[model samples]
Target: MPFQLPDALATSDDKPALSLLRRYYGDAVTSAGAAAGAAFDGWDSTGTRTADVDRFTADDLLAITFLSVRVPPRAAAVLLRDRAAELGDLLAELGPDRDLVGEDEPLTDDCWPGWRLQTALRDIPGIDTTTATKLIARKRPRLRPIWDKVVAKVTGTHKHQWEPVRVALREQHHALHERLVHLHGAAGLSAAVTPLRVFDVIAWREGKDRGW
Candidate 1:
């Protein structure tokens, strides 16, 4: 059978690939947490990896919501599980270092892109690379290397440092996200399900309350 599109369907800015996704999924599109929720739900529905000291069972919610953004559907399931496992190891290895790093300096403005990615991830709780990858991708958005907090605090920056209050606030805001959502529409866009947008939404909200 030949294919057709609805009159209301929006074209992808570049790839026809997105159009196909839009035609089928439509407004059935998701809100920000949907994908992570799905991945989390999917994991939970199965009951796979819930141990302790490393309780990353399949049912676990989301290590990092952004992860689903980069992974293709076929690869997502396996990677989600593997990422969760990796997160378990990460938690065991570096998750406790936050205090040692402390709230003292945070991440100042002059830091490199690598510094930016790591600080953002650490600030956001319950996120692993799968979730962090999206944020990393945002900084690079090209799938180069995952610039997560552990790598920065432990590997990249060497010593610990906090970002500037304004910069930290900027990093957390994710202000452009809503625009991206409106331009792309939630359903067909992969970003819909991830924290990629949530980061911005959360930040924008935090900024609004700063008057106190």
Candidate 2:
């Protein structure tokens, strides 16, 4: 089935959820951006670029996920030591789809690396759909979207599964990307936060604040 946003979010008169999200985005720009910047500096000191996941130590994983997604220490540690290389390869293969906007295609697991990565990461202990996708988003900010519990609820996605949610995001990527980009600029946010991050924050806030 083709994906669709819930009617409350899509056509609400008050748009309270969206208002809350905009406020959250502004707060994240100043607050989360500062915290993430400091943590990222520490990460870069270890010479671990986003694509160099193979070079990531347990400490690196802990620090990055703490800064970005707040993944639990134990889970981050396990993922760090065990599946770093596999995760890296997935991100490298996914890369950035510059032509994503141009393609007149429906997203499928076979064509979307995010879906494939979510499936592959399922085998890794301590890395569920939320954590796995957040890790990917941290590495490839422009290409991947984070799908925490809040995001899943807001989007009406199936819990504990990521491909359907990812496919939905891929279908809306172009318009959503443009909106996030506009919001980033209009809000006077720093370049440190990417459009995808903003989208995640917005969706998270909607689910969290409005109980979507």
Candidate 3:
């Protein structure tokens, strides 16, 4: 109801989106061979996707979604045109919470209309505990599990079956997020990983038993 994810990796769309990110952005995980400013985001909504610019790849959903929403007037013509400048401004605003979304344009949902974590993951603000904990491996260049319909296109009984894995990674991500906070401070990080964005990430990894 609120949001969901599949228990297992059932979505083929993930590969396309992820591949697009890896091919174009090369790497979003800086410490893990990814470029410093590279990102691995994509969109799978019923919305149409446009070509990206030289600066950024439009194939990935992040650019597609951002550009689509930010400026739909000429979506077909221009995407990621001023992406670098926009990303720079956003990074300055979100910094530590950079992964949440495009920085200042804080993401929200019916639950967290303001800058707060979801109720389930609120206990761990700036980081959605329930969502991040699922299938998240404990390692550097750690990917904060993102969300989309691919994950929930169907209903799986073993929602979040990777709780053990999630639990293991939760502590690490928490520590890392905290470390980032200490390094960057709360305002930027918290503002960056808004509830909706984080929720989307979590929801993207949903299943039948997911609401845990």
**Whole-model Cα lDDT per candidate?**
0.33, 0.54, 0.29
Candidate 2, poorest ten consecutive residues by summed lDDT: 33-42
Number of the top-ranking candidate, with lDDT as the measure: 2
TM-score of each: 0.26, 0.65, 0.25
Model 1 Cα lDDT, one tens digit per residue, 1-212: 11111112223342332333333233344422332222321233443433332333322324334233333343444434545465444445432212111233433444444444444443444544445544333322211123234333222221232222212223334333333344345334444233223222222222323431
TM-score of 1: 0.26
Q: What are the per-residue Cα lDDT tens digits for candidate 3 across 11-93?
A: 43344323322332343344234222222233323333222211223343233233112223343222235334543233233
Judging by lDDT, tell me the better candidate of 1 and 3: 1
> Highest TM-score among the candidates is held by which one?
2
After superposition, candidate 1 runs with Cα above 4 Å error: 1-70, 73-87, 96-102, 105-200, 204-212
By lDDT, rank the candidates, best first: 2, 1, 3
